[model samples]
Target chain A: MLVARGVTVAIKGKTLLQDVDLSLSPGQVLAIVGPNGAGKSTLLKAMTGERKTTGGEIELDGRALWHWTTAALASRRAVLAQSTEVVFPFLVSEIVTLGIRRNLTAAEQYRLVQRALVAVDMSTMSDRVYGTLSGGEKQRVQLGRVLAQVWSHGCTYLMLDEPTSSLDLSHQLLILRLAREHALSGGGVLMILHDLNLASMAADEIVALKDGNRIASGAPVDVMTDDLIAALYGVRVQVRGVPDGPFLLPQTARLPG
Target chain B: MSAGGVAMPAGTGAASARRGGLMLAAGAVLLVAAIVAALAIGPIFIAPADILAILADAAHGIRPTEGIAMRDAVVVLDIRLPRTILTALVGATLAVAGAVLQGVFRNPLADPGLVGVSTGAAFAAVLWIVFGGMVGAFLPQAVLAFALPISAFLGSLISTVLLYSLATREGRTSVAMLLFAGIALGALAAAGTGLVIFVASDQQLREFTFWTLGSTGGASWFKIGIALPFFAALFVGSFWLARGLDALAIGEAEAFHLGVDTQWLKRLAIVLVAAGVGAAVAVAGVIGFVGLVVPHLLRLSAGPMHDRLLIGCALAGGALLLLSDIVARTVAVPAEVPIGVVTAIIGAPYFLYLVHRNRAALGG
Candidate 1:
C-alpha cells in the first residue's frame, strides 16, 4: 500500500500542490484526473518520492517512504516519467536492463527483462536502438523498463505520470490494460490520466484535482457524474452509461471563429 | 503493431560481455604498442628491441648492457622514457576526464578543455611560474617547487565547481546553461592568464608560453611521481563511476527513479574530472583534444557503455597522446612543435564533422 497525506509541493515559492491526500492499497488502481495545471503530475511526483513535499508525508507498505533506501524502494516500486529522453544511442535492451536491481544475477536480469518486454509487446524490438524508435514504441519500451523494475514480486507500487500521452489509441489501451493487470495481480497502481473514459474503465477509484485541491474522490461510477466533470473541467460533458461502463462525451459545440 | 521495423536479436548478455571484453583487450594491446613506439622514436632513434631491452633492464634493476652506448642509455632512461611515461599518464587521465565529463554533461561535445578546466589550470600554472620567486621568499623551497602543480589542481577544481553549480538548478542541469557557463569561465580564466603574461619577465613569458602550447619536454621521473597518484585516483574513480553515468545518460530523473544516488555521482564525477585534468595540465601543460577526440572515436566503435568507454578512453587516450607527442617532437625536428598544436590540428576536423552530424540535436 502507498499513502500520501496532506502532500504539498512548492517550487520557486509557487505552490504547485497543496494539502492533497491520497492512498492506494494492494489490487487497487487509483487514477488522478483533472484539467491541465491541476497538480496531477505534481501529486504523482510527491507520491513517488521524486519531489520533496513541502508539508505532510508519504508512506509505502506501512513505512514512511523516506525511511526506505532508494535501492530497496526501487525493488518494491517503479515510476514512469512523462518522456524517455535519451541523448545517446543506447539499445532498447540496454535501456530496459537499467531497471534491474544490482542484486539479481545475470541470468535473472536477462529473464526479467525479456518477460517485461514481452508483457509490453515490445519483445521483437529489444535489439533496436531506442533513439530510432517511434514515440509510441518508446513509450512501450519505457513501460517495459518500469515493469522490469518492480517485477521481482508481489504488491509493487507502479506510479505513472501521463504514460500514454505519446501512445496511439491501441497502445494507450494496451498500456492501461497492463497497469490494470498489475493491479489485479495484487499490485497497486497510481496513474495520472488525461483520458477520462479510459480512467473510468480502468481505475478502481478516481481522485479528481482542481487547482491543487482534491475536488472529489470515490468510486468512478459515483464521482464521474456529468455535474462533477463539468465543475472540474469547466467544460460541459454528457455521461452515458453503456454495458461495459460509463462513457463520457463532450457536449459543448465549438463556436464559429 | 510492428512499429520498430527493425531486426530484433536474441538477448544475450554473454555476447555483449564478450564483445566488450574483446574491445578492452584490443585497446590494451594498442596502448602497449604505442608505448613501445613512442619510446623508440625521436631525433636519436633507438631500435624497438633496444627500447624493450632497456625497459626490461630497468624493471630488473640491471645496469645497461656492455654494448649499449652511454648516450643511448641516457637518452632512453633520463629523457625519452620519462616523457613517454608522463605522456601516457597525462593522455590517459585527460581522456578519462573527457569521457566522464561528456557523460555527466550529457553532451558528446563536452570536453575538459572546452569546459575551462584546462584553461583554468593553465592560468594557475602561469600564476605560479610568474610569482614563484616572490612566493618563495616566504615558503620553504620544497613546497614552492611542488606548489605549481598543486595550484593548477586547485584552479581546475574551482572552475569545475563553478561550472556545475551555475548550470545545475532544482536538480536539473540545463545543457545550454552549462555550455554558456563554460565559455564564460574560459574567457575569465584567459583574461587572468593574460594579466599574468603582461607581468611576466622574458624567461617567465617563455615558460608560460610552453604551458599554453602544452608539451611533454619537461617530463622527468619527479614530475611523473607528482602526477601518478592523481592518475590512479581518476582511473579508479572513472571505472567506479561507469554504472552511475550509464544510468545518468538516460536522464537524471530516470536515473534517480532507478535508485541511483545522482547527487553523489555528480559530485564524484566533477571532482575526478578536476583532479585528473588538473594534474595533467599541471604536468604536461594544456594538452588538448586527447580527451575530446579519443572518447568520441571509441564510442563510434566500442558502443556507449561507460565501463567499456572509460577503459577504452584510458588506452586510446594514451595511445593517441603518444602518437601526437611523437608527431610534436618529429614534425619540425629539433624545433619541436607544441603538443597542443599537434592535437588541435588533428582533432579540429573531427570536431567539425561531429558538429555537422549532431546539428539537428544542437538545434542549430
Candidate 2:
C-alpha cells in the first residue's frame, strides 16, 4: 500500500499542493481527477517521492518512502512520468530493457522485455528506433518500460500521471484495463486522469482535487455526483448511476456570464 | 492481430548486438593496421618485417649488433615506438573523454575541445611554460617535472565544473546553455593564453606556438610513463561509467528512477576527462577532432550502448589519431604540419555536418 497524509508542496513561496491525503491499497485502482492547476500531478509527484512535501509524509508498504534506497524502491515500485523523451536512437526493445534493473539471466531479461512489449501492443515495432515513433506509440512504449520495471516484483505500486493523455480512445481503455488488471493481481495502481468517465469505469475509488485541496474522495458512486463535479470543475454536468459505476454527462455545460 | 503478416524477425536486439560486436572487431583491426603503418611508413622507412623483429627482439632483451639493422632498431624502438604508443594512448583518452562528455551532456556536439576543456588545459600549460622559472625555484626537481600536467589537469577540472553548473538548473541540463557557455569558456581561455603569449620571449613564443598547434614530436619514454596512469584512470572510470551513461540518455530523472546515481556519475566523468585530457595536452599539446570525430563515427556504426561504445571509441580513436599523426609527420616532410591542423581539417567539416543534421533538435 502507498499512502500520503496531509501532503503539502510549496516551491519558492508558492504552494502547489496543500493538505492532500490519499492512499492506494493492494487490489485497488485509485484515480485522481481535477482540472489543470488543481494539484493532480503535484499530488502524484509527491506520492511517487519525486517531489518533497513541504508538510506531511508519504509511506510505502508501511515504511517511510525516503527510508528505501533508490534501487530497492525501484524494484518495489515504478513511476511513469507525464512525459519522457529518449535522447538517443535507442531501439524500442532497448528502451524497455532499460527498465529492468534485476540481475536476471539473458533469457529471462529477453522474456521480460517481450512480455512488456506484448502487453503494450508494441511487440511488432520492437526493433524501430524510439525517436521515430508516433506520440501515442511512444507513450505506449514508455508504458511498457514502466510495466517491465515491476513485472515480476510482487506487491509493487504503479504510479502513472496521465497515462492516457497521448493515447487514443482504444489505447486509453487498453491502458486503464492494464492498470485494473495489475490491481486485481494484488498490486496497487495510482493514476491521475482527466476523463471523469474513464476514471468512473476503471477506478475503484475516485479523488477529486480543487486548488490544492481534496474536494472529495470515495468509491466512484459517491464521488462522481453532479453537484461535486460542478463545484470541482465549475461546469454543469449530469451524473447517471449505472450498474458498474456512475457515468458523467456534460452536455449542458455553460460558462458563467 | 496480423502478426503473421508482419514477418517480425526474432531477436532484432540480438542482431544489433551482433553488429556492435562486428564493429568493435573492425575497429580493433583498424587500430592494429594504423599502428603498423605509423611505425613502418615514417621518414626512416623501416620495413614492417624488421619492425616486428625489432619488437620481438626487444621483448626478449636483444639488441641489433651493427649496420642498418642497428640504425633501424634505433629509429623503430627509440624514435617511432614511443611516439606511436603516445599517439594511440592520447587518441583513446580524448575519444573516451568526448564520448563521456556527450553522454553527460546528452548531446552529440559535446566534445572536450568544443566544451573548453582542452582550451582551459592549454591555457594552464601556457601559464606554466611562461612562468615556471619563478615557480620552479621553490619546487623540487621531481615536482617541477609534473607541474605542467598537474596544472593542466586542474584547469580542465575547473572548467568542466563550471560548465556543468552553468548549464544545469534544478538537476536538468539545458543543451543550448551548455554549448553557449562552452563557447564563452573557450574564448576566455584563449584570451588568457593570448596574454601569456604576449609576455613570452621569441624562443618561448615559438615553443608555445608548436604546443598550441599540437604535436607528438617530443614523445619520449619518460613522457609516456607520466601519461600512462592517467590513461589507466580514464579507461577504468569509463568502464565503471558505461551503464550509468547509457541510463543517462533517457534524462536525469528517468535515470534516477532506474536507480542510477547520476550526480556521482557526472562527477566521476568530469574528473576522468580532466585527468585524461590534461595529460594528453601536457604531452602532445592541444590536438583536436580525435575526441569529437572518433566517438561520433563509432556511435553511428556501433549503436549508442556505452559499454561497447567506450571500447569502440578507444580502438577507433587510437587508430584515427595514429593515422592523423602519420599525416602530420609526412604531409610537408621536414616542415611537418601540426597534428591539430590535420585533425581540424578533417573534423571541423564533420562537426558542421552534425550541426546541420541536428538543427531541428538544436532548435528545440
Candidate 3:
C-alpha cells in the first residue's frame, strides 16, 4: 500500500499541490482526474519520490518513502512516466530488460521481459528499434518496462503519470485494463487520467482536484456527478448513467443558451 | 493483438551478445594489424618479419642476432616501437573517454578535446615544461621526471570536476549548459596557455608550441609507463559502467527507476574521463577526434550498448590513432607533422558532417 498525508508541493513559492492526502491500498485502482495545471501529476510524482514534497509524509507498506534506499523503493514500486525519451537505438527487448533486477537469473529475466511485452501486446516488436516506434507504441513499450519491474514483486505499487495521454482509444482501454488486472493481482495502481468516462469505468475510486486542492474523493459514481465535474473543469458537462458506469459529455452551446 | 498484429517474441537475448562478441573479436584483429603496420612503416622502414622478431626478442630477453642491423634495432625498438605503443595507448584512452563522456552527457558531440579537458591538461603540462628547471632544482630526480604528467592529471581532474558541477543541478545535467560551459572553459584554458607561452624562453616556447601541435614523437618507456595506470582505470571503469550507462541512455530518471544509482554513475564517469584524458594528454599532448569519431563509428555499426561500445572503442580508438599517427609521420616525411594536426584535419570535416546529420537534435 502507498499512503500520502498532508502532502504539499511548492516550487518558487507557488503551490502545486497543497495538503493532498490519499491512500492506495493493495488490490485497488485509484484514478486522479483534473484539468491542466491542477497538480495531479505533481501529486503522483511526489508520492513516487520523483518530486520532493514541501510538507508531507509518504509511506509505502508502513515504511517512510524518504528513508528507503532507492533500490529498495524501486523494488516495491514501478513508475511508468508519461514519456521516456530514448535517443539511442535500443532494441525493444533491451529496453524492457533494464527493468529486470540483477538478482534474477538470465532465463528468468528473459521470461519476465517476454511476459511483460506480451502483457502490453508488444511481444512481436521485441527485436525492433525503439526509436522507430510510433508514440503510442513507445508508451506501450514503457508500460512493458514498468510491468517487468514489478512483475515478481508482490504487493508492489504502480504509479503512472498520464499513461494514456498519447494512446488511442483502444490502446488506452488496453492500458487501463492492464492496470486493473495489476490491481486485481495484489498490486496498487495510482494513475493520472484525463478521460473521465474511462476513469469511471476503470477506477475503483476517483480523486478530483482543482487548483491544487482535492474537490472530491470517493467511489467513481459518488464523486463524478455532472455539477462536480463541471465546477472542477469550469465547463458545463452532462453525466449519463450507462449500463456499466457514468458517461460524461461536454455541453457546448451553439448560442448563449 | 487486434490490429497491431501479434507475433512471437523476436528474442534478442543471446544473439546480440554473440554478435557483440564477434564485433569485439574483429576489432581486436584490426588493432593488431594496425599495430604491426605502425611498427613496420616508419622512416627507415623495417620489415614486418623483422619487427615481429624484434618484439619477440624484447619480450623474451634475447639479444637481437644474425638478421637485424644495429641502426634498425635502435630505430625499431627504442624509437618506433615505443612510439607506436604509446600512440595506441593514448588513442584507446581518448576514445574510451569520449564514449563514456557521451554516455554521461547524453550527447553524441561530447568529447574530452572539444570540452576543454585536453586544453586543461595541456595548459598544466606547458606550465611545467616552462617552469620545470626552476622546480626541478629542489625536487628529487625521480619525482622531477613525473612532475609534468602529475600536474597534467591534476589539471584535467580539476577541470572535469568544475565543468560537471557547473552544468549539473538537482541531480540533472543540462546538456546545453555543459556545452556552453565547455566552450567557456576551453577559451579560458587556452588564454592561460597563451600566457604561459608569453613568459616562456625561446627553447621553452618552441617545446611548448610543439607539444601543443601534439605528437608521440617524444614517446619513451617512462612516458608509456606513466600512461598505463590511467588507461587501466578507464578500461575497467568502462566495463563496470556498461549496464548503468545502457540504463542512462534512456534518461536519468528512468535509469534511477530501473534501480541504478545515477549520482554514483555520474561521479564515476567524470573521474574516469578525467583520468583517461589527463594521462593521454600528458604522454602525447592532445590528439583529437580518436575520442570523438571512433566511438560514434562503432555505435553506428555495433549499436549503442556500451558494454560492446566501450570495448569497440578501445580497439577502434587504437587503430584509428595508429593510422592518424602514421599519416602524421609519413605525410610530412622528415618534417614529421604533429599527430594533433592529422587528427584535426580528419576530425573537423567529419564533425561538421555529424553536426549536419544531427541538426535537428542540436536545434540548428
Candidate 4:
C-alpha cells in the first residue's frame, strides 16, 4: 500500500496542494478528478517522489519515501506523464526494452518488451521508429512502455497523469480497462482523469479536488452526485447510471436565489 | 506491417518511417573504404602500390626495392602516418562528442566545438601559454611543457559543468536552454580568447592564430599516441551507452522513469564530450563542424540508432577529416591550407541548409 500524510507542496512560492492525505491499497483504482490547475498532477508528483513535499511525507510499506534510493523507488512504482517526445529515433522494441534497465537480463528484457507491445496490441509495430508514429500511436506505445516498466520491476503502484488525453475514445476505454485489469491482478492504479463519467465508470474510489483542496473522497457511487457535480464544476450536469458505466451530460446552469 | 517500413501502432495516425538496413550497411562500408582512400591520398600522392609496399615492409620487415630510399619509408611511416592517424582520431572524437551531446540535450544543433567546449579549452590553453611564458625564466622546463593542455582540459570540464547547471531546471535539462546557454557561453569564451590574442605579442599571437586555424601541418607521433587511446576509450563508452541513449531518444523524463538514470546518462555524455573535446583541441586546435556534419551524414543512413550512429559517425568523421586534410595539402601543394578551413567551407553551407529545412524541428 502507498500512503501520503499531510503532504503539503509548494513550488516557486505558490502553494500547489495542502495537507493532502491519500492512500492506495492493493486492488484499488483511485481516480483523481479535478479541473485544470487543481493540483492533481502535483499531488501525483508528490506521491511519486518526482516533486519534493514541503511538509509531511509519503509512506510506502510504513517507511518514509525519502529513504528509498531513486532505483529503489522506481522499482517500487511506475509513472507515466502526459506526453513524451524523443529527440533521436529509436525502434519501439528497443525503446520498450529500456523499461527494464539494469534489472533484467538482456534476453529477459527483450521478451518482456515484446510482451508489453503485445499486451498493448502494438506487437506488429515492434520495429517501428518511435518518432514516425502519430499522437495516438505514440500514446499506446508509451502505455506499453509504462506497462513494461511496471512489469519489469513489479511495481505495486502505477501513477498515470492524463494518460488518455491524446487518445481517441476507443483507446481511452482500452487503457482504462487495462488499468482495471492491472489493479485486479494484484496491482494498484492512481490515475488523474478529467472525464468524470470515465472516473465514475472505471474508478472504484474517487477523490475530487478543487483549487488545491480535497472537496470529497469516497466510493464513486456515493461521492458522484448531481448537486456535487453542479457545485464543483459551476454548471449543471445530469448523471445516468447504466449497466456498462455512468454517463454525464452538461445542462444549462441555474443559480440559487 | 510494412515491407520496408515500420508500421504505426494503434493510435499513431500514420505509417512508421523505416530506413532500409541495406542502405545503412552500404553507407558504413562505404565510409570505411573512404577512410582507406584518405590514408592513401596526400601531398606526395603515394600510389596504392607504393602505399602497400611501405605498409607491408613496415609490418613484415620486408624492405622495398633498392631504388626506394630509406627517406621515403621514414617519410611515410613517420610523417604521413602520424598526421593521418591524428586527423582520424581528432575527427572521430569531435564527431562522437557532437553525437553524444545531441542525445544528451535532445538537440540536433549540438556540436562539441561550436558549443563552448573548445572555447573553454582555448581559454585555459591561452592562459597557461601566457603565464608559462611569463614565468619561463624561473620555472623548471618540466612545468612549462605540461601546463598548456592540462589547463585546457580543466577549462573544458569547468565549462561543461557550468553549461549543464545553467541548462538544468528542477533536475531536468531543457534542450532550448542548453542550446541558448551553450551559444552564449561559447560566444563569451571565444570573445575572451580573441581579447587575449589581441593583447599577446605578435610572435605568440601568430602561434595562437595558427592554432585556432587548425592544421595537421606540424604532425607529431606523440600527439597521435595520446589521441588514439582517448578516442578509442570514448568510442567504446559511446557504443556501450547506445541503448541508454536510445531510451533518451524518446525524451528524458520517460527514460528516467524507465530507470535509465537520466541525469547520470547526461553526466556521462558530458564527460565523454569533455574527454573528446579536450583531447582533440589540445592535439589539433579547434577544427570546426566535423562534429556536426559527420553525424548528420551518418544519421541519413544509420536510422538514428546511437549504436549504428556512433560507429558510423566515427568512421565517416575520421574519413572526412583525413580526406579534408589531404585536399588541404594537395590543393595548396607546398603551402598547405588549414584542414579546418576545408571542413568549414564544406560543413557551413550544409549546416545552413539543414537549419533552414529543420527550422521548426529545432524550436522550443
Candidate 5:
C-alpha cells in the first residue's frame, strides 16, 4: 500500500499541492481527476518520492518513502511520467529492456521484454526505431517500459500520469483494461485521468481535486455528481448513473431559455 | 498476431548485437593496421618485416643480431614504439571521453575539445611549463615531474563541473547554453594561455608553442608511464558508466526511475573525461576531434548503445589518432605539422556538417 497524508508541496513561495490525503491499496484502482494545474501530477509525484512534500509524509508499505533506496522502491513501484523524451534512436525492444532492474540472463531479459511489449500490444513493432513511431505508439512503448519494470513483482504499484493522453480510442480502452486487470491481479494502480467518463469506467474510486485541494473522494458514483463536477471544474454538467459509475455530459446554458 | 505478418522472435536484438560485435571486431583490425602503418611509415621507413623482427627481439630482451641496422632497431624500438603506444593511448582516452560526455550531456555535439575541456587543461599545463622553476625549487624532483599532469587534471575537472552547472537546469541540459558557455570558456582559456606565454623565456616559449599545437613528437616511455594510470582509470570507469549512460539517454528523471543513480553517474563521467582528456593534453597538447569525431562515426556505423559504443570508441579513437599522427609526421616531411592540426583539418569540416544537419535542433 502507498499512502500520502496531509502532503503539501510549495515551490518558490507558490503552493502546488496543499494538505491532500490519499492511499492506494493493493487490488484497487484509484483515479485522480482535476482541471489543469489542480496538482494531480504533483500528488502522484509526491507519492512516488519524485517531489519532496513540504509538510506531512508519504509511506510505502508501512515505511517512510524516503527511507527506501531508489532501487528498492523501483522494485516495488513503477512510474510513467506524463511525457518522456528519448534523444537516442534506440529500438523499441531496447527501450523496453532499459526497464529491467534485475539480474536476468540475456534470454530471460528478452522474454520479459517480449511479454511487456505483448501486454502493450507492441509485439509486432518490436524491431522498429522508437524515433520513427507515431505519438500514440511512443506512449505505448513507454507504457511497455514501465510494465516491464515491475513485471515479476507481484504486488507492485503502477503510477501513471496521463498515461492515455496521446493514445487513440482503442489504445486508450486497452490501457484502461490493462489497469483494471492489474488491479484485479492483486496489484494497485494510481492514474491521473483527464477523461472523467474513462475514469468512471475504469477506476474503483475517484478523487476530485480543485485549486490543489481534494474536493471530493469516494466511489465514482458518489463522488462524480453534477454539483461536484460543477465545483471542481466550474462547468455545469448532467451526471447520469450507470452500473459502472456516473457518466457526465456537459450541458451549456440551454440557449438562454 | 492480429496482423498478417509473422511475429518477431523473442531474441529480436540478437541480429543487431551480432552486427555491432562484428563492427567492433572490424575496428580492432583497423587499429592493428594503423599501428603497423604508424610504426613502419616514419621518415626512416622501416619495413614491416623488420618492424616485426625488432618487436620480437625487443620482447625477448635481446639486441637485434640479424639484417636489421642498429639505427633501424633504435628508430623502431626506442623512438617509434613509444610514440605509437602513446598515440594509441591518447586517442583511446580522448575518444572514450567524447563518447561518455555525449551520453552524459544527452547531446551529440558534446566533446572535450569542442567544449573547452582540452583548452582548460592546456592553459594549466602552460602555467606549469612557464612557472615550474619557481615551484621546483622546493619540491622533490619526482613530485615536480608529475606537477604538469596533476595541474592539467585539476584544470579539466574544474571546467567540466563549471560547464555542467552553467548549462543544466532542473536536470535538463540546454544545448544552446552549453555551446555558448563552452565558447566563452574556450576563449577565456585561450586568453589565459596567451598570458602565460607572455612571461615565458624564449626556450619555454618555443617548447610551449609546440605543446599548444599538439604533437606526439615528444612521446617517451617515461611520459607514457605518467599517463597510463589515468588512462586505466578512464577505461575502467567508462564501462561502469555504460549501462547508466544508456539509461540516461531517456532523461535524468526517467533514468532515476529506472534505478540509475544519475548524480553519481554524471559526477563519475565528468571526472573520467577530465582525467583522460587532461592527461592526453598534458602529453599530446590538445589533439582535437578524436574525442568529437570518433564516437560519432562509430555511432553511425555500430549504434548508440554505450557498451558497444565505448569499446568501439577505444579502438576507433586509437586507430584515428595513429593515422592522424602518421599524416602529421609525413605531410610536411621534415617540418612535422602538429597532430592537432591534422585532426582539426579532418574534424572541423565534419563538425560543420553536423551543425548544418542539426540546425533545427540548435535553433531552439
Candidate 6:
C-alpha cells in the first residue's frame, strides 16, 4: 500500500497542494486526472516522497516513507517523471542500466535491461546516445529505464507524471498498455494524465483534482460524469461511455466569459 | 570514433570487461606519453632513459653525472619536476570535482571552478599575501608558504557552502540557477581579490597578479606530499559517484524513486567539490577551462557514460595540464610563461573549436 494523509506542499509561498489524502493499492492503476496546474503532479510527488509533506505523513507497506532508505524505496517503488535535465550526453543502455543498479548483479541486470528495452520495443536503440535520440525515442528509453526498475524489483509501486506528453500515438498506447500489464502483474501504477480519454481507457480508477484537492475519485465511469468535468475544468465537457472505457469530449457549449 | 557496432541492445560484449580494459590501457598509454613528452623537451633535451635515471636518483637525492651538468639537474628537479607535478595534481583534481558538480546539478555544462570555487581560493590567497607581509618578521617563510594553501582551501569551502545553499531549490539544484549563482559569487570574489590588489603597493600588486596568473614556479616536494591524498580520495570518490550521477541524468524525481538520495548525493557532492577544487587551487592557483574542455572532449571521443567520462576526464586532464606546463616552461626558453596563460591560450582555442564544430550540439 502507498498512502499519503493530509499532505501539504507549498513552493515559494505558493501552496500548490493542500491536505490531499491518497492511497494506491496493489494491482490497481490510479489515473490522476485534472486540468493543467491543478496539482496532479504535486499530488503524485507528495505521495511518492518526492515533495516533502508539510503536515501529515506517508506510508508504503504500513511503514512510514521516512523510515525506508532512499535506495530501499527505489527497489520497492518506481517512477517516471517529466523530461530529464542532464548536461552530459548518455547512452540509452547506460540510462536503463542505472535503473537496475541497486538490486541486480551484472548478468541479471543486463538481462533485465534487455528485457525492459524489448518491452518498450526499443531494444534496437539501446546503444544510441540518449541526447542524440528524438524526444519520443528518449521518452521510450526513460520508460525502459523505469521498466527495468520494476522488473528487477518485482511488484514495485509505480508513479508516472505525464509520461505520455512527449510520446507519439503508437508509443503512447504501447506505454499505457505496458503500465496496465504491469498492474496485472501485481505492481501498482499511478499516472497523472491530462488526456482524460487516455485515462478512461487505461486506468482502473480515476482520481480528479481541482485547486489542490482530491475533488473526485472512483471507477472511471462513475467519476467522469459531465457535471464533474464541467465543474472541474470550468469548460463544458460531454462524457461518453463505450464498451471499453469512457470518452470525454470538449463540449461546444461555452458559457460566456 | 568507433560507435562500436551500431547494434542496439548491445550484447554483454558492448560494455563488457574488454571495453573497460581497452579504456584503461588507452589512459595508461596517454599518461606515459605525456610524461615522456614533458620530460624530453627542455633546453638540455634529456632522453627518456636519462629522465628515468634522473627520477631514480632524485628518489634518493643522488647527483646525476657531471656531463648531465649542474644547470640540467637544477632545471629538471627544481624547476620542471615541481611544475609538472603541480600541474598534474591540479588538473586531476579539477576534472574530478567538475565531474561531481556537473552530475550533482544534472547540468552537462556545470563546471566546479566555474561556480566560484577557484576564485574563492584565489581570494583567500590574495588576502593572505596582502596582509601577511606585515608579519614577515614574526613568521618564517616556510610557514607563510604553507599557510597560503590553507587560506585558499578555506576560501573555497566558504564559497562552496554559500553557492550550494543559494542554488538549491526544494532540495534540488537547477543548473541555470547554480550557474548564475556561481557567476555572481565568482564576480564578487574577483572583485574582492581585485580590491586587495588595487590597494596594495606596486611590488605587492605584481606578486598578486603573478599568483592569479597561476604557476608552479615555487612548488616543492612538501606541497606534492600534501596533494596526493586528496587526489586519491577524489579519484576513488569519483568512481563511486559515477553510478549515482548516471541515475541523476534522468531527472532527480526518477532517480529518487529509483532509490538515490538526491538530496544527500547533492550535499555530498558539494563537499567533495569544495575539498578537491580548494586543495587544487591552493597548490597551483587558478587553471581555467581544463575542467570544462576535458570532459566535453572525452564525451565527444569516448561516448558519455560516467564510467568512461570520469576516468577519461581524470587521465586526460592530468596529461593536458602536464603538457601545458611543459609548454609554459619551455616555450620561452629562459623566460617562463605562466602555466595559466598556456592553458588559456590552448584551452580557449580548443573550446572555440568545439563550439564551432559542434555548433548544433552546443545549440549556440
Best by TM-score: 5
Task: Give the winner by TM-score: 4 or 5.
Answer: 5
Q: TM-score of chain A, model 6?
A: 0.94
Best by lDDT: 5
Candidate 1 lDDT by residue in tens digits, B1-364: 0113322244533334545667788889989999988888888889888877777788899998777776888888899889999999899998899999888888887778877888898888788888867867898877766787778888998998898789778656676677789889988987898888887777775665566669998899989988777788899988888888988988888888888888899899988888888889888888777888998988766767898889899998998899999998998977888999999898878778887887776576
Could you tally the backbone clashes for each prediction? Answer: 0, 0, 0, 5, 0, 2
For every model shown, what is its TM-score relative to the native structure?
Answer: 0.92, 0.94, 0.92, 0.88, 0.95, 0.87
TM-score of 4: 0.88
RMSD of each: 4.1, 3.6, 4.0, 4.3, 3.4, 4.3
What lDDT score goes with residue B219 in model 2?
94
Arrange candidates by lDDT, descending. 5, 2, 3, 1, 6, 4
Worst 10 residues of 3 chain A by lDDT: A248-257
What is the per-residue lDDT of model 6 for residues B201-288, given as tens digits with 9 covering 90 to 100?
Answer: 8775455545566777667788787766656767787787777777776677777887878777777676667767776876777777
lDDT-better candidate, 1 vs 2: 2
Local accuracy of candidate 5 as per-residue lDDT tens digits, B192-307 = 98888877777875565555568998899999999888889999999988989988998887788777878899999999899998899898888888888998988877777888
**Model 6: clashing residue pairs?**
A87-B108, A88-B108
Could you give candidate 1's per-residue lDDT for residues A7-95 as a string of tens digits? 88888888889898999998999999999999998898887777889898899889998898766777788899998688777777777
Q: Between 2 and 5, whose DockQ is larger?
A: 5
Name the candidate, 4 or 6, with the larger TM-score value.
Answer: 4
Question: Which regions of candidate 2 fall more than 4 Å away from where they truly are?
Answer: A152-155, A250-252, B1-9, B65-68, B132-145, B201-206
Candidate 5 yields a Cα-based lDDT of 0.87
Q: DockQ of all candidates, in order?
A: 0.47, 0.46, 0.46, 0.41, 0.47, 0.46
| lDDT (CA) per prediction | 0.83, 0.85, 0.83, 0.76, 0.87, 0.76
Pairs that collide in candidate 4 are A86-B250, A136-B11, A136-B12, A137-B11, A137-B12
The digit string of per-residue lDDT tens for model 5 on A1-257 reads: 89999999999999989999999999999999999999999999898888888998999999999999877888889889998888777888888888885577666677788899899999888877888999899999999999888785443799999999999899999999999898988999999999998999999999998889998999988887777877877777788986656787655312222
Q: What is the Cα-based lDDT of residue A243 in candidate 4?
A: 76
Question: Model 6: runs farther than 4 Å from truth?
Answer: A10-15, A234-240, A248-257, B1-24, B56-79, B112-114, B129-146, B165-184, B194-206, B350-364
